[model samples]
Target chain A: MARREVSVLFFLALLCKAIAIRSQPSTIDASFCLSWRLAVETNNELPWRTVPNKCSQYVEDYLIHGQYERDLELIMEQALDYVNGISIVGDGKDAWILDVDDTCISNIYYYKSKNYGCDPYDPAAFRAWAMRGWCTAVPPILKLFNKLIDNEFKVILLTGRDKEILGQVTIDNLHNQGFIGYERLIMRTNIYKGQSAVTYKSNIRKNLEDEGYRIWGNVGDQWSDLQGYSFGNRTFKLPNPMYFVP
Target chain B: MARREVSVLFFLALLCKAIAIRSQPSTIDASFCLSWRLAVETNNELPWRTVPNKCSQYVEDYLIHGQYERDLELIMEQALDYVNGISIVGDGKDAWILDVDDTCISNIYYYKSKNYGCDPYDPAAFRAWAMRGWCTAVPPILKLFNKLIDNEFKVILLTGRDKEILGQVTIDNLHNQGFIGYERLIMRTNIYKGQSAVTYKSNIRKNLEDEGYRIWGNVGDQWSDLQGYSFGNRTFKLPNPMYFVP
Candidate 1:
């Protein structure tokens, strides 16, 4: 019995040795992960409070390694494949919905200058940056958009920015940043004031579908952009750990 | 001057109203969202820190509305539909991987008694719960598992539980709770001690694929379960706002 147990233990040890997982730091530790998450939530929701100072270094490290950009590229690659595989079911009705901020253009420079959540979000400063029309295109998503356009898919730009106040600047920024020829640019209206993003985007998409547009792909960095009815055939979410919309 | 500025003033008023995106709790003002978030990260990563008391009511409210259950059901329903649609390419090597805890059996009863992160995690008490073999199955996931089995896809169980310490108990618990006839049940060994869930699960899944098993679908509550390569053709994530696992 002792000999048999030794053999079994030996075999098990071999199996365990063969299975070496966790070699890479694919997932961050608990404290680090939580800190990162809190940074995002505070940035998007509670912009008044500053993120903990200790977490700033970790956030910088994450961004420095280009983690967010890498994830976006991989996810958008899948998006490309998915869109490429689909057959457009109708004419001028095959539309792809794209969220504006963070989805197509990045505000990383602005966030970085603010110490990556260590500083409170300043709406006036953000508006100033928006008006400058200098934010760079999120390369991966921009590439995906170009492919969709190349494939004859109607591209619609949707955003939460004030259409009346920032509308012209927003358009100029997209055009300046290499995004062009979108089917339509839909911005928040007085009707959607104070409403949740899910409610606002859902209503708009439903209206577009009602107008004979078939949303083939919907991509966004926020859950509000993807969830709810009238969500396209497939929804691709790009990472934005820096903020949560709601 | 007043008459000349009338047009600009009217336009500005229209713009302000139109741009009112973040007005109605643009973010949930309650500290609950942050607290709830911290709780999940702590449970999965640190497991030592006590989640704040202020967020307990919010967590309770989320649980009371059956939000977690509802989300799981919806996600699993999607998984079921996705798995059903796939055309099996291999003889019998196609598999559906599942995480055991929270994904299959739920420890909600034990958690509710602990005030949902108000108290520090007690492993001894948790082990006692594990030994009882009474934790209920996450209903929707259980249903998904049954369908996968019925569909003849190889159903494999992977979990972060220690194989040496709780292997038999885990097996019995799964079997007792209506989960039966899985192709394999993999648990963490001494070799993977103190590793992140993402690293551990990723290596294991990669190994399974290396052994020629084609993973068709993966369902889990944590990002760690779904992020790595050799991931299933499709990944269905269940909602678990209560606790995160790596």
Candidate 2:
């Protein structure tokens, strides 16, 4: 009876080890956690693609969602703390700031470029995207945004998406996503266009001071999204280990 | 006589061609002439390094006075226009914003990483500079800063230099540099500290708003100095091309 019990324990350990090996690619590391959304969207071969494989694998069942979500929450919380702590507008201070694409809408199709994301750079395809549908809201962020809005905060959706693709599409997307209460949707243009992501975003922030609505809090996946007010030109940087392919 | 005249003309033409080729590098491209100052001082090298060889050579001439000063006057006028025309500060009505250090001081030495100009990152050296002992002002900008101050509605000196450094060294440096009657000195660390440049400088801007200040202009050398208000993380920016070796 003792030998039988030991054999069962040995089988469970082996099963656990196998599950871990199959759920995550060996190359996946810490930094990639931040950009995982984009990564998974862009990579068809990503472990999540095989639904049954994921569920059957104990590692994916126990690890993927919880670990990924926890890391994301921590970074977002840190970012929100930095944004909300700001008091730089009106008599009491605070301004509206936002990011285009993922923050305000769903452009996950671009991930199809790897199997998930569409490359917005391709003119005709980009135009199709711009002309086609409204952006969808990201799941986790909706509740927080509503909470802030309830507290009397204004919103701004600043994105690195080309100015050419903005205007109506952006407004439609914002409305479709239920990302209301925004005073402006800042986008990149040829006039102020330059390579440095720092200048692109922060310069816009400097300009946004015009309406006297200082950004109270900003949320987005790329580091540059929240910038315009901080370190400089980095985009929603959180970690992007998953998708540097593009 | 026609042959002689042709020979003489030919010789002059060769001289002219040779001069054009040799001096090509010293001629600042019209495009760069406009944005180089802000871009350069913001990161010190973004524009200068990007300048074609012809334009790059022009920097040395501008480094000195005389014909170079004339060239500088033209560029400064353009820089002022760039600042005023496109600047997004103080409800888009503020006059100008300027950065200290490499922007105002001719710290090509520190930039080059060899001369160890007025303020070296070295603790003792920086402490000594903080002594304020007859520190010389950066030359090219002396006339510019003074000119703006004399005509000032508002002249803000925004710098990413640490607050602790603002003590005697910074105060004395400002005094010696002949800067006075400024509304504010935007400094670093008034916000939060992160390993990246974005958060370091953004905090300073946030604190300013808390104090009821409206930033009209922003100027600095490193990207963090001017555009740090972007997303919250500092990217340890690539480098100041003019001085950064690593």
What are the models' TM-scores?
0.48, 0.38
lDDT of 1 at A200: 92
Q: Which candidate number maximizes lDDT?
A: 1
Model 1, residue A205: displacement in angstroms? 0.7
lDDT of each: 0.72, 0.46
* Residue-level lDDT for B2 in candidate 2: 54
Looking at model 1, the pairs that clash are: A40-A242, B40-B243, B40-B244
lDDT string, candidate 1, B1-246, tens digits:
355455654564554444443222113323335333532422222232554576666567555655455545545655666777888865789898999888899887787887875777788988888878788888888898999888888999999988887899998889888999789999999998898988889899999999889998887877678765666776666555555565
> What TM-score would you give candidate 1 relative to the actual structure?
0.48
lDDT of 2 by residue, A38-144 (tens): 22321211223222222223223222334333433444554455446544434633545556565545554443342332112354665576677645666546645
Residues A118-165, candidate 1: write the lDDT tens digits.
Answer: 787788988888888888899988899899988999999988888888
Least accurate 10 contiguous residues by lDDT in model 2 chain B: B230-239
Cand. 2 TM to true fold:
0.38
